[model samples]
Target chain A: MIWNERIECATRDEMRIIQSERLSETVKRIYHSVPYYRKKMQDAGLTPNDIEDIDDLRKLPFTTKIDLRDNYPFGLFTVPMSEIVRLHASSGTTGKPTVVGYTRKDIQMWAEVVTRSLCMAGVHRNDIVQIAYGYGLFTGGLGLHYGTENLGASVIPISGGNTTKQIQLMEDFGSSVLCCTPSYALNIAEVIKEMKVDISKLKLRVGIFGAEPWSEAMRKEIESKLKIKAIDIYGLSEIVGPGVSCECEEQCGMHINEDHFLPEVIDPETLEPVAPGEIGELVFSTITKEGLPLLRYRTRDLTRLHYEECACGRTLVRMEKCKGRSDDMLIIRGVNVFPSQIETVLLNMSEVEPHYLIIIDREGTLDTMSLMVEVQEQFFSDEIRKLQELRIKITKQLESVLGISVNVKLVEPKTIERTAGKAKRVIDNRSI
Target chain B: MLIKQLSVFLENKSGRLTEVSKILGDCGINMLAFSVADTSEFGILRLIVSDPERACKVLHDNDFSVNLTEVVCMNCPNEPGALAKALQILSDNQITIAYLYAFSTGDSANVVLKPDQLEECIKVLQEHKMELIEASTLYKI
Candidate 1:
């Protein structure tokens, strides 16, 4: 699972050489194989020869998710389907899911990088790894599955769902490492409390959570409940999967595998590179992806890149906690609102349940925002006057917190539809 | 028994009351017996609407968290201690009331009861020979 440690811990010259070589080859592959890439490159009046090195990346046409989707299926593959070993794609709402093909070489590389990611997270060969992400075409499951195997760790591919079964396997397998989305992890912890599962009997030592963006508060909460260190994993279907980057034991930021993937931060608006430390949209160039390679892929994932050496031995680039996707931001009355922000506010509010929805609609020409909040039954003596007073308090709190006047409607116990997967918290009806 | 109810999960807020009502008015669902169970940040608006299912869907489909629950409804007098008389009847029969709310149907006060002691409450209601309104009868009344 050696992923070019020199490039990861490269001296300035060696790093430049590695990027220059991979950047050139990626350009050549896209130009030769992908019709969409060839068209985009032709439109830019560029050829594979023009992108001689990493600095010449400016000369190359940037590949976006739209390009991948528009082309669809095997449109981006550098090789034929016979050469491809596995296919993975995004489960994002609709259309021919952005498909990715992995050559046998590509799968091995993926397993290697994923293993590197786990090792960076302090997972050793002896640990029992429980992967709870969805399998099938989704990369989270199999990618981690192979990676844990690559790490020579006993992997329980529990997959996602059936929380009771997940617990059963964790207890039976005596899993030492847990992997799943942070929300599901939290839900599992909640179930354990209700069922009185002996968490102390569980051998889980570390948990890696990703697939959806979450906050530091959530991380601490998960860590405390599981009595294990919780770390963030960053990746998307377009680039690789869960192992493109991951938080090290340091937990300062997720370490991006610099040799395989080159990271950049760009102004989402200007489409220009942002200053190093500034928060902006994260872009990745798959310098080494053989099948379905993407160059300067606009991840739309908002994060920052830092070249600082981590406390761990790895000198790979580190990415800050993703704030939110540039696309996921909601413009309510000219104010940019992120569902994560609302979640942050709600999680902080002891009075509110974690379940909530932000409803945006057109009231005349202006926008109206209403948060449907659920009140705990125990908190109220079932008194109406106090309930009315509580409602007013919530409204005031939302206004203060969001810096926008929002109406808060109180809900009863378990009224909101519990999301079985990712919570659909934002409903924007302005389009209708 | 069948009764009008709006089962909306609401985060507590000042104008939220006005908002759901305004939407329901637009949809033509009248709020009959309404009670809000509140926490600090959110509240649940439990209502007996003229149409239970329609009201539930209207609130739910609009992203307002809604739920359905069944409770016994009784028509009592508007007079003071009328509720006490009912409570005593249940207490004497060792019935525990989980929660209750009052709403007026014309001049008569109808008490909504969600009893903790369902069997005892039913026994007391039957022993006292209090008229148990059928779903159709309650809807028509």
Candidate 2:
């Protein structure tokens, strides 16, 4: 079920040529139409002519989230307002969101890539996809919606939340495919069990889960609970939401649509490209995007890329599941820790639920990290000593893995807040 | 010989106890006997309620972590050495009481005991002719 096989199955040489030609055009367009990009290029003493091929990507200055914020709304858009047909923005926790625009052709291109992403996951024209990702300002909802429609599949565009309705529609519509964040999928599974719905009666077969990084252990949990094959799809709103790459049925790694979105992994400290297949921060260059053709945008997502062709017969470069976002990496007691590492450890244990919260605070110049975990109901004991022993066991494991002592606090089940979108796992109280 | 006790997990904070009491009070669930084991971080609120099953359900509905545990409830004379004599019987038989709490009513006191060996502790107490309160009678009171 390889959609757009001509580009998806292109050889390395073929992809390189396609990428080089598109990248050259994208660079020239931004340099001429975007003052921000033109000034950035001028400051770097580089011209659009210098970017002759994909290899010349290093010559251009990197675009970061801060740069997008500084430009604000429509500052970096290459096309005029008349040409921009749609806009989607990623919500910023502190201030204004990062806005991205798309022309009519751009939207069509988005749908094409997303359609290819769905096909990679084994979805076809006959399958009904229930898109549970949040709609509106976020790109996940509409991004997946158009793609599902583009694939000629039936789409139940019932956006996020309203768990009961989601389940009802799932049962009524006989949706064969599901799309949403991994956390929301877990929440749906929990609700289904609570409602005593017989999952066998549901026709769901495959799930395309993304928008946030999830662990392999979580994938297993979702698979066993929902009785469906959960495929990981990776994308951010900044560089054409959720269709930048997606895992094929092979399930080894996500195949990046490199012909359209050129991928690079670089060391955050030195900004130099990491050796092939090495873990580093991911950067993207929109090769064929029109409305918002970014040069080299630092995605801040950390992952490694595999150049070998996948068993699924797609020669698109595959990226490992994101380890964690570099921005989410916390430096506590001078030790760099990612919430995903703690998530991996928690998911491995059978006595605790996957829900957890990491709280970091400063006391008298000493940094402290306290983890609150919920004990499984079956594991709860009337005796305090037994519960205390479980706490100590968790603390010891975390200390050994994190190389820093962590205060483990045992909370009751459902104590941690669950969201329909990304789960907030860390709370840093330290002002500095 | 065996009674159900509702044990709840409460984080150490102001008004948490009030919240639990309010939930039970609103439902007309009476607390027969109760105890709280506290730490700096959290507290375990152990309670003997008139309706254990209903109380557990209501508390759970209110998002409180409540569990039903089996404990031995015995009636002891409301006088000095009465509790000690009953406890001495279990101590003599090498049966350990993990924790115990009591509430006095009229001439007798109702004592709830959670022992390391529940069945063995009940057997030892019955052999010694200690009057154990029936769960039904305790709930009625």
Candidate 3:
């Protein structure tokens, strides 16, 4: 079931040679085209000539989200706007987004990688692929869309939401493959139950779910509920999207598309590379991206990379599913949520105190966020209706901002624990 | 008059009620009345004690979600029809009782009820010539 067997089943030395040539060329290109990267290299007292191979990649300074944010809109693009054909952005620390641009070649490369990913999930030319990922500024939807097409499969470009219609199309179109976030897959399963649609009627045989971290238990739930093989795919907007790596049929670990993107795990605190099979923050170097070429970009996603050959016969390096993040970012239902984002919503409202605690838990297969906020002394009321209204107001504001429903609990003033140092913001009890 | 009632939240677990009672007993807080309101998962144990503030402090120190609420306590005659007459007055006045528990002491039955409208319930009971037990006398009894 290995896709692109020539590349995927390459020997360790062969991958290094391919990675080395690509990395050297990418370094030289960025050093010449992007001043930000040139400055970082110059600051490190290095030149493109200093990086002769993939081993010299460590000599280059690591790029971070903050660096991306500092660059803002198109500052990171290596090519002119005329050459860039597409753009995708994920949420940044502030209101602005971390932007990525893609040239035509880059788009084709994305399609190829994702095609390999879909093929790894056992999808083929005859399979009717359903792209449920959102198709807008986010890269998940269109990334999978073109990739399914590139794989010579019949693709249904049905973007996310409209659960009822999605089910109808799944039945009528005989969609054999589904692509979306794991949580959205669960949401679809829920809607399917409510609609009472006969699962047997649908031809769904496999689901390639990603765009957020998920657990084995969640995979089992999705598999049993949808009666399909639930496969975990890994990608982020920074280094392509939804196709950087995916699980082969063996399902042990996701095979990283090392030819297009290079992954390195490092201790987030020490900035030192970790041994293989050790968990650390994931960093990527998009050696093949034409528009936006990143070198040693810190993704902040923590996971372990395994070099052992998989049963699927892919000699490419496989990474365990991301365990968690090295930062304070929280993913709720596939949407990134920062406690500071919740803080911004609370501080904007006048009736509540600034103190809040975010509690995240797993209710069955879905993740739930419950925010406990303290009420101001003047705004506190004995009336249950008034308190409920305040809770609703907070919930609505948070939902609008975070793009996920939140349960808000308004407590008495000073009910939230006060800490002299950094306040504890999130309490995650999920076993995942 | 309003009596201070201690409401302690308890997870529905074995020995949770026993733990609360033990804490109160160890603190030497005499419980005059106790009742439990529960669903399947959790329960609220409501107690009228000799020293409610101290009992609340002890329970809270033990990590219980404790709150002090005002409940109205009135004496009903120790007869079958006596309770119905007092309830009819509340029903006629459109006052809803959140919960109620009764205990007999000294030939009279004491009915401690948490009404939806505490102030209105007191006023209605006073107009109906019902003897409302103040916290001081009720604690001693």
- Compose the digit string of candidate 2's lDDT tens values, residues A1-432: 998999999999999999999998888888898888888889999898999988899888998877887888888998899999999876432235678999999899999999999999999999999999888777888999999999899999999879899999999999999998876788889889989999999999999988766678879988999999999998878799989999999899999989889999999999999998899999999988988887789988899999998998999999999876768766554344667778777877787777899999866334689999876556776667777888888888787667669999887667788889999999988654
TM-scores of chain A, one for each prediction = 0.76, 0.78, 0.92
Candidate 1 local lDDT, A119-170, one digit each (tens): 8788989999998887877778898999999889998888887888888888
Residue pairs in candidate 2 whose N, alpha carbon or C atoms collide under 3 angstroms: none
Report the C-alpha lDDT of model 3 over A2-79, residue by residue, as the tens digit: 568889999999999999999999999999999988998899999999998888988889998888889999998989
Candidate 3: what is its chain A TM-score? 0.92
- Across B31-104, the per-residue lDDT of candidate 2 in tens digits comes to 98999987777778899999999999998887777789999999998888999999999999999987899997
What are the clashing pairs of model 3? Answer: none
Question: Candidate 1 or 3, higher lDDT?
Answer: 3
The model with the greatest DockQ is 2
What TM-score against the true fold does each predicted structure earn? 0.61, 0.61, 0.73
Candidate 1 lDDT score relative to the true structure: 0.76
lDDT, candidate 2, at B96: 93
List candidate 1 segments past 4 Å from native. Answer: A1-4, A92-94, A329-432, B1-141
